[model samples]
Target: MPSRTPSSALYKVAFLWNLFWGVPLLLAPSLASSALGLPQPAPGLGELHARAGGLAIVLFGWVYLTIGGNPRAFRPFLPIAIVAKAAFFLLVAFVCFFHRELLAMLATAVGDLAFGALFYRDWRAVR
Candidate 1:
């Protein structure tokens, strides 16, 4: 098993990083989008989409928080979440590459990939 300290530190970083996105997203999706330079949705469907996305992110963030506290307890979730993060990064990157206006959102893609790598490393180290 990997030393608990290094793995734990990675998990803590993951937890905090997820929180950084979750809080703003759940509280104010528009502001979060603005900060990321992502395009805002229109008042009707756009706003609804943003809000819904925010809710989803909050739920995912909760999962990250849970796992960070006890990776072994939540070991089963590790692979799935790691893959999801990787997919998210790829999806965002693809979308941004096609849409110039969404280029700023690439920052999140980069962050997501980094976190996914760290999460994978920590999870694998245990075995």
Candidate 2:
């Protein structure tokens, strides 16, 4: 493996964070959503959202971990990561803009944006 970059720490942080957030959603959607200040989904919808989102997050988290190991190969994915987070940010912003009280969900988007920025910064530095 190549030597670790300045952003290696950031990648690791994002990896762990994603595990923390994603696993629970995959394994315990109701609990995770409740803690996040999200309303309960209609019966089956909970599992659908939880499992799907969790899978995405966990899978992407693995990608981030891979980047930590071999950024030269994975740094190209940074832009996709940014798009992922930006999508979340925009979705949350739009929803919260109308609901007003569900702003707590924005926290997740904030974290995503921060991690995305870190990835972008490191990708640029390495290039």
**What is each predicted model's overall lDDT from 0 to 1?**
0.76, 0.81
Off by more than 4 A, model 2: 1-4
TM-score of each: 0.83, 0.87
User: For model 2, how does the per-residue alpha-carbon lDDT over 76-97 read when each residue is reduced to its tens digit?
Assistant: 8878877887787889889999
Backbone clash count, each prediction separately: 0, 0
Query: What are the clashing pairs of model 2?
Result: none
- lDDT tens per residue, model 1, 1-127: 4365325666666667767777776677778878887766677788777778777766777787778777888878888778978998999888878898987778877898988887787687554
Which of the numbered candidates is closest to the native, going by highest TM-score?
2
Residue 112, model 2: lDDT of: 88
